[model samples]
Target: MTEFDRRKFPPPEDEAMLPWYRGIFDCGFISLHPFFVIEGLDPRLNEHGTLVLEGKDRPAGADFIKWMDQLSAEHSKGKELHGRSVDHMAKRFGQMIGWGEMCERLGLEDHCELDAALRTHIKGLRDDLTDPEAADRMVRHCAANRIFLPVEGDIPPLFEAKLAAMFRRAGFTEIIAGDEFGDDECIVPVIGLDNEKPWITRDDFPTYGHLRLMAPDHSMLAWVHWDSFYTAIFATKERAASLDLDTTFEGFWCAEETKTFWLTQRPLPLVQPR
Candidate 1:
């Protein structure tokens, strides 16, 4: 796992989610699909009384993610479907999304293009979801969100110590470390990118990092949450807003989606292990 790269971006003091994401971009997590997708074999409407997908009987966003993830599942039975790749669709719709444009830029263009098979598949899937006449071909997780932010860098003794202290003081319910958990989940104060390979690397992150959050919305929420969700933990939004954003942001990145905007957005890492 990589240590938080403080020199590349902002510190962990910002209240808005934007700065945190910026920090992640500095580490190299590219936004492929702005929307996290999910697919469910069974479907049900939610409290929103809207279309729903089947799952482990969890949050609405989970259903949405399941619905969208089927980039190929829509063609399972008597169906044929396709659409843009998750990463490609994410980049294409980056304009409508908040931090997506930034995420797109930070990622490398190598694997960032619309994939061939996945591309064709998503196009069909999108159309089906857009206009579903039957049931089984139902797509669920269609909520758009920015999830991944790869972190790379040597650990800074000072920053590491500070965050370790913070987590220790918070007495979180969970802690994590190492590749399995760290690479997939854990949040970091700083993240670095392998712009050359265009993949995210991790210094510290682990499974069961409780700081990892899901999107607040169900159907309108993100798919995997991609270790990139945050809000004012305790402080009110106003209180969080009063705080500085620059001090915590990671800044611009070279995105793979578009040649125009710079990518930015990072995860807030978990300092301890569970």
Candidate 2:
């Protein structure tokens, strides 16, 4: 195990009052995915959910780097990584590969396109993990989309029903259930394409499903989920206004370049079932 400075990633001072921070701490370990994916850190998530530092003697780390290096060399020579092609790697890792690598391997133009592709691929993987047709899908999906799926079991049906009722009360009806992939602890829902139809029930939805509310025109209005501690709401400005979220919770608009919505407080109390 590579030693990390706990002081550098100190627990939030207000964690007791903030549900989101509390929920993260409850997981028992902080993931270094963002550090690796965004900042090019040496750590990567292995199949066992352990962090492996690239080029280090932390046995797993060394093996992972060696494998990746071999794959890269083979790729340059127009060969597959081991027997698996780049396409196979993409389908297996989902969004874990950096945007540049994913685009290069998948022949995509940009990150936006890569995001769309991963969402579809991950959905299929989650829907049928045991299907013999794709034996490695589960492993690949987990490696790529860790923390997005529930580790123990599905979110409670009764809680989901209450969440649905809350959304309906807030005037959102075209809700679909599914997981969203992103860096933040909260799941982020993307707007469904025009050709896609919403699933009618949780059973019809994929595993680790969260509630995604859509506007009448199929634009995403909000992505909502409960982390067994508090509800996380990511909603458009207009939708957040409808819910009086700005007045009720501490939140901020996402980065101007990436999205046009507010990530309302880590743990929202407004919709918690009494």
Candidate 3:
């Protein structure tokens, strides 16, 4: 059976803005057709009542939700309106009048416009999914907030090489590069570990404590989730501060148990290779 390798399927060009679109989609503001089409994958509910792609044994719904939650948490960081966190405000308004109406009242018209453009682009009606104005806005937003988006193009060989070297420096010997997946081209940089066990029954997830690196823009991100801990290490302090780490951790519903460390102040840990 052919397994679905997430590393091989990189994120769409608009990865930085996908969470808002996905949140809108989840709220019934847009159809899932463009989302799946833009992602280059077709997923459906299997007989086991799990969302899966054809020929893949793994259930993908959990991973999809994880990705969404992580990105959405990051997207909401440092964004505020009327002295309330945008995420908090959204949730409150969503609960009262519903998400669709909340978006309408909040003037989130750009999301709908962007979704329409993506659908049109996929159908070959436009040369690009993003307009110059929107692109500029995204760039400025990321810059001002110190948010990092994946670089445009194939993952840089040098960046991957550097990540491998970092793992080696941390005393890992059985490093294996896992398939790239996610809109951010997240890849497991380490794989083999002593006494390793599957984190879950899903075949696509790593069976060992591994380090995953997402695509780099101004900074690189190495995420580790094992032993009931979820830690994300960024290449720079500014980048680390860009995210509301507490809020991000809370999104996992493990704030009380998870211990996060910023790489800017501490040495990276050497876990069994991914």
* Per-residue accuracy of model 3 over 1-274 as CA lDDT, tens digit each: 1552322222233332123223121110001110101121111110111111222533566576666556545544543232222222222221111212322433435333433332232232244443545444543543443332221112212123333444444444433322233323223334421112222222444433343543323233444322112223333334434333322221121111222221112222222111
Enumerate residue pairs that collide in model 2. Answer: none
TM-score: which candidate is best?
A: 2
lDDT of 2 by residue, 1-274 (tens): 1542221122232332223323222111111111012121111221211121234433554567577667455444632232212222222232333334434544555433433333333342234222332223423543463322211112222223333444554665445443433211222232222111222222345445443333343222334322221133444334444454333322222322212111122311121111
Give the residue spans of candidate 2 off by over 4 A. Answer: 1-55, 60-166, 178-204, 208-219, 223-238, 254-274
lDDT to native, each model: 0.26, 0.31, 0.29
Error of 3 at 112 (Å): 16
For candidate 1, give the lDDT: 0.26
Instruction: Output the number of the lDDT-best candidate.
Output: 2
Name the weakest run of 10 consecutive residues (lDDT summed) in model 2: 27-36
Each prediction's TM-score versus the true structure? 0.21, 0.25, 0.20
- lDDT tens readout by residue for model 1, 1-274: 2654322222242333334434222222222222122232121111111122435544666555665556225433342222212223222222222233332443313222212112222232334232232111112222122222221121211122223333333433233322322235443332221111111123354323222221121001011121222211211233234322222322222222222111122222212111
The alpha-carbon lDDT assigned to residue 189 of candidate 1 equals 35
The residue-level lDDT of candidate 2 at 18 comes to 20
